[model samples]
Target: MAFLPTTKEEMQEQGYEQVDFIYVLGDAYVDHPSFGCAIITRTLQAFGYSCAILAQPDWHKDEEFLQFGTPRLGFLVSAGNIDSMVNHYSVNKRRRDQDAYSDDGIMGKRPDRPTIVYTQILKRLFPDVPVLIGGIEASLRRLAHYDYWDDKVRRSILIDSQADLLMFGMGENTIVEVADALNSGLAVQDICYIRGTVWKSKTLDMIVDDYILLPSYEQVRTDKRAYAKSFMIQYENQDAINSKMLIEAYEGWYVICNQPPLPLTQEQMDFTYSLPYERTFHPKYHYVPAIEEVQFSITSNRGCFGACAFCAITSHQGRVISTRSVESVVAEAKTITQMKNFKGYIHDVGGPSANFSRPACDKQQTHGACAKRQCLWPTPCPNLKVDHSHYVDMLDQVRALPNVKKVFIRSGIRYDYLMYDKDETFFDRLVQHHISGQLKVAPEHVSAPVLDKMGKPRKELYLRFVDRYYEKNKQFGKKQFLVPYLMSSHPGCDLNSAIELACYLKKIHHTPKQVQDFYPTPGTLATCMYYTGLDPRNMKPVYVAKTYEEKLEQRALMQFSYPKNYEIVYRALKKAHREDLIGNGPKCLIPKNKPKQNASFKQERAHRQKRYSKT
Candidate 1:
């Protein structure tokens, strides 16, 4: 019989449960391998225990019923799917009465910033219950981290959340061992010897399993400036894993291996994606006919090929994309379709880099995906290439099915790849069935130097892609338009690059009218650049964006299109003497309303100094 907790206090009093366990919190959306949630959720599932993923739980009210509903098993605490900055993002979305900033991503997510609040509440309600924390939010915040969004180096999230254990990296191997040991009546200290895990010993000392000593997940978070240097050094060929670092340790009866993760079978992959309540949380939707689940509840592909510097795809899932076959994906889709009170809308069918559908080319399959290297770092391995043709076809396959009308991309598709296509037919088809009128594409930047630093090609490619897109749209007389995603203050971005970006947006007769002040997610080459001003894996000079003055300039360039921003734009243009864009001379194209600096000058100055020195 599978393990089951006798009761809540048994869980709290037992120090840690054995094999019978419950993963308490994480992933408002179903986790995918391409995303960090994949490693944590799938690893536990791999060890032969039926798992329940509580995507989003109501914390304000008593949720003890949820704890009792599951078989008594150890509980896993995760927010990797939703980072702690859940509030930072949500607050940015809310246009404060007098505030100037906002957020992007057309899916319209104004998540309750109560991630930590909910986590803490769960702790209070389940006192003494074994809580294991792991995921980007928990992992990266496991140690003092430089928060670009906060402009401060903060302490470990474990210290903040009071979680018992915070496993880092891919949590499968470590989490399995953790559950087994606790279930076997082992102490937390016994599990510390395992690699890629962070746990407080019985004595309450933080013991990070550092066998191979990979950079802690905390080291991955950074502001914009450090990322510039990172961009210069990260490239494709540098792709390599230090096999010399491999080692194993104990987690109950099983061994935790730091070696490359074993490839998952298509059946296992299907089963993982095919999980039910684990994917959706809205029982209301269980009865109501809505467009989609109110919050996140998705089952998508495992990995993506696009290695955009700003993305964490390759690091989390390896550069080689691993996915269930399209038939498996369709089967999972059918499950959602068959759910009670099902709506015709299937939320999304994409992964880390949405349009990214294929896996490793050649080098990765032979050399092994570098857990440490980045495709956008020093350069892309000619081998670390992405072919979106398969994904485009996948989109077609999903949408053409019976009883499914729309499938949105909550994840952003790779615009650079789509724009690079030599044919117009794909564009036509995408507009027809897939886009349903408007779609969001991340071009990141338009300046050549900035794009180069960001590991993006140039503005020309995006423009070419845009032209082709519109050509098809005009031909079809369709209004399905591309909403360009623009990022400001990235590693290589500056006031000049922002201005250049503004110029390009004008050429295309478009205005994002929305700007993303780049949030440096953990585990990307860019985060290293944004941290140490060079890729920690390599050293190289790079441009940076961190100054308040420069940020305003970038915003002005974006605001040149919106007349409402004219006061700021006019003053900014006059100050910069770029009156060439003032009046009707020409339209400056860029997103409007960059976020306000939610900080004082001293803190901001400290950040600028720290960022500038690295650059």
Candidate 2:
């Protein structure tokens, strides 16, 4: 349960002459299980590997990476839990001022593209040392991917970073297997067949003929459509049971990605959670803002089945839900209550999608999720299982525990999936107990066309959920609200669709406090659509707002209530030929501005009224 050695001095104090693996990270050393570094390092320790953390090492200097001298096993690097480019910048490509993962919540501690930058540094320092890259940045960019920040199709991160190997997805099983292989004195290049990993080879003779061959890096670079096609092929083969080996040629080298490993079984889930975690940041720091939110929270599950187009969860965590037993979760809850500052509250107990406690259907376990179709999109599959009794029972057990005031499910709930269920027992209780005055749901947009492009359920389902939510709240005699998370300028969203969404917001008297412009990060269906202007699913043309001004206008339309957005909204309305929304009327989005002559007349009328009142 002690903190891992973060320094050479700490390593010496721990009675280790040589460390096994030195983990280089983009984030501050937070030992919480929510962090991939914490989980991977703890799992390695459980298997008797001496590991040390080299978190947020200064990238500009070579001395920072050599602190541990050199690890006996290898080097493990991650760009923290999130991609470094995403962590450092906003959707507008503007620099973000604060990093929640940093101590004191300051930015600039980690370099942009930390995985590539850190690995390149490691390769420079010790050329012979094995460097393995993983985490979101490495996982999503494992192949030739469109880089939004750079605005180019970059080669797979392994090609750029020159790291010997890359592991994708939740890498608990893979990392250990990698350590065992490397510890046995096998060459890094010789260990290429492990699941959930990407390895580079100088030639194609090592690749199996049956493995899927994506369009070469050269082809995908010049052809945006080819990139989309390649992304679809990657998407279809994410499942462990049915996935094929994939090989993509990058010039003279081949980047081979073996099939994803089987999802952790319930037993594995229990064991992973049971690993000793300090459940907070290393005590040397004063404050880690990320810990405050997750200190009392628990991740009851992993992965998500809601394959929304903009999400990377399907690619990172896969669509299959791997869950810990109710007993394991409750045991963690009991441990939380025993903490010194144990508040009466359990902040959250959920995963990628909170309510997805189990797989979508029974068949997914043996046959794998359907590659071509979604579980709860367009429409819920006929075989989709819709039960919440187990989740409700688990929540009941936690609620009944001593010293626990309230338990919340704050991650998110798929409202459409909730509505699809025939039973409503969980719904009534969710409103009564779980909601902290408001429940956050992501409707994304109100336009059916845009929703279709986003692979979300129709607007009709959201409307029904909205109506039923209020009714349920009324029954509970509690006043609560739904905070709808809205996005603008996604693929298939034009100025007219933006206006339609603005009108719907007005109808509901809702002005969103936060508006998210579509951020096309790597390895997403939406990102592919954004880059190609074509839906990879069917190669249908999609309307994409690519220009900065057009994207700003779409975002402004979502929050037209602010005076600053008035000009942009006005321009959008005018350009869309929806001038009807620009006039001074009840249904108008913005008032049409008049010329100086009208202003003078209004001033004269105001003066007359003032003079008459004085007389």
Candidate 3:
């Protein structure tokens, strides 16, 4: 047989008139050649079950939908990528039992995309075809979930999405079995028998069979804000690890699907890394590239090593830097070069603090860098040695390819590790090839107490790097500058610290254009801080900008706090009879006249309730 037979040839061999099944899906990374979708889809193919990858579907446009496409035995509904994006997940932020403002977002808004809602339409159109759903989103939302902003418990999204069956957690293992059973002409409900899935009971009521819920993730409430906060905490802290599965006694006859399919073995990881992933992104959903600023996206690693107090990457992929070999990376780079717009560049070549590969440190201590949580969560067994030298060689090779322009490292790099350049370092070379005019780094905040609370270091370290950076920029006559990403009003950021940060930023001349106020996401250390006013990791009291007014002041400062912050500060000073240092001396970082509290959530809710009542 020919080494790589055409799709038609493979179809001929099957001797079947139709494909085994088709996949209507969603995942954080769509390039089927990279993530979990890659494994599941490829495995089905090996079993003679054909599959199509429909990344994030725009149900609004019937043309883009696949409800009427060729029928098959069944449809596998995977939500890890797409559902997670819609029902965004975060490792850290804040969580409240009640939500005062949660509602279906407006028309044309992203979170409200009609995929699941329209999946119901798919059911109407193809009434008999099975629509099985599974992935992180379905897994996490398998039961009645509390929406903090809405301040109400929302039903399982799996139920709402109208999937025939919902599976959860790392699904590489369960999906294969589901595919096999379907190919054998098994009933869709038969899939519920598999572990790691959620389906209806025989009683015709929702039966949420046990699905794996990482301890870190289970803590999150469904409010979108809480998810973001959770994400930030999970991304911080160099030595953070991952959380374990929880099997409870009180959920009622629930089977604890606590066993997440074991981490993808190296061979499986290699198979994914070697796929022709570059072309996997369906060009129809073109906005994906626009938002990412890259024609195509790729992944180098599946997980993160740094379990920051505010990040959730660990919660999703675990702390181990499960990676593909350099050879596999090279193969992917070759495919990316063949893109039609094939501008001589591979969009982004990294994931989760891209610079560090397979953490060199052990889980116990920090000789290198540890992404461990004090909670003894399963992080990369710290002693996992990272060989960045391979990356340097890979970047050099990628740039050397024909038509390959500057290979950009658009994925944010961990500034802390970049600063820890050993023996002249990989960062120096990384700067030349990957960084454009400026390397985008996330040194989230500058306040010491805030930094500690966020599992980050002080502002001095960021300054030290900046000083050295400017000196180099001047020496080389390179106008390339550094854009430092900052956040305000996180749990530890009080008005004073926010003001100090605003003033310090102005003094440095590198004022940020993008400023994020602390959004309390579910399952994050920072969110816990907002909820309890204490950093969970450090057990220290911290500032929580809980009230609307305080959140407003802190957020306003991040944007020049009214371009004339000094004026606001001056006014306050004058009112205190301390006018001596107004114009001639120290200026303030806050605005002179504070804006009136908008009370957006309260007003919006009242307005919505009134409108609903009118109806």
Q: What ranges in model 3 sit over 4 Å off? A: 1-19, 25-43, 52-73, 78-131, 139-149, 152-174, 181-245, 248-257, 277-292, 360-387, 471-477, 528-543, 561-587, 590-615
Candidate 2 global CA lDDT score = 0.90
lDDT of 3 by residue, 1-615 (tens): 111112333445646445656555543234454445656666566655666554445656655445336547766655434333324422222221221111112123323323365467567667788877655555545544433344444445555676677666556667777777777788886665564555653342343543233222234443434433333333332222232223221122332223333445546766755544434443333333222343445566666555466664544455555666776777777777776776676778788768766544454232323333332122223334545776677677777877777787877776655565553346566555566788777778877777777667667777887887767667656678788888877777776677667667767755676667665443345655666555545455666766765665666566653443444444434544544433433454433344454577458768867865664
Error of 1 at 559 (Å): 2.1
Which candidate, 2 or 3, has the higher lDDT? Answer: 2
lDDT of each: 0.54, 0.90, 0.54
Off by over 4 Å in 2: 593-615
Best candidate, lDDT-wise?
2
As a whole number from 0 to 100, the lDDT of residue 528 in candidate 1 is: 58
- Model 1, 262-368: lDDT tens digits are 33445656665553333422232232112233222344455555556776654444455555677877776676677666677766776666665655555655565
TM-score of each model, in listed order? 0.69, 0.95, 0.70
Query: What are the per-residue Cα lDDT tens digits for candidate 2 across 168-253?
Result: 98999999999999989999989987999999888877666369889999999999889889999999999988889888998789
**Reference-based lDDT, residue 583, model 1:** 48
Number of clashes recorded per candidate: 34, 1, 72
TM-score result, candidate 1: 0.69
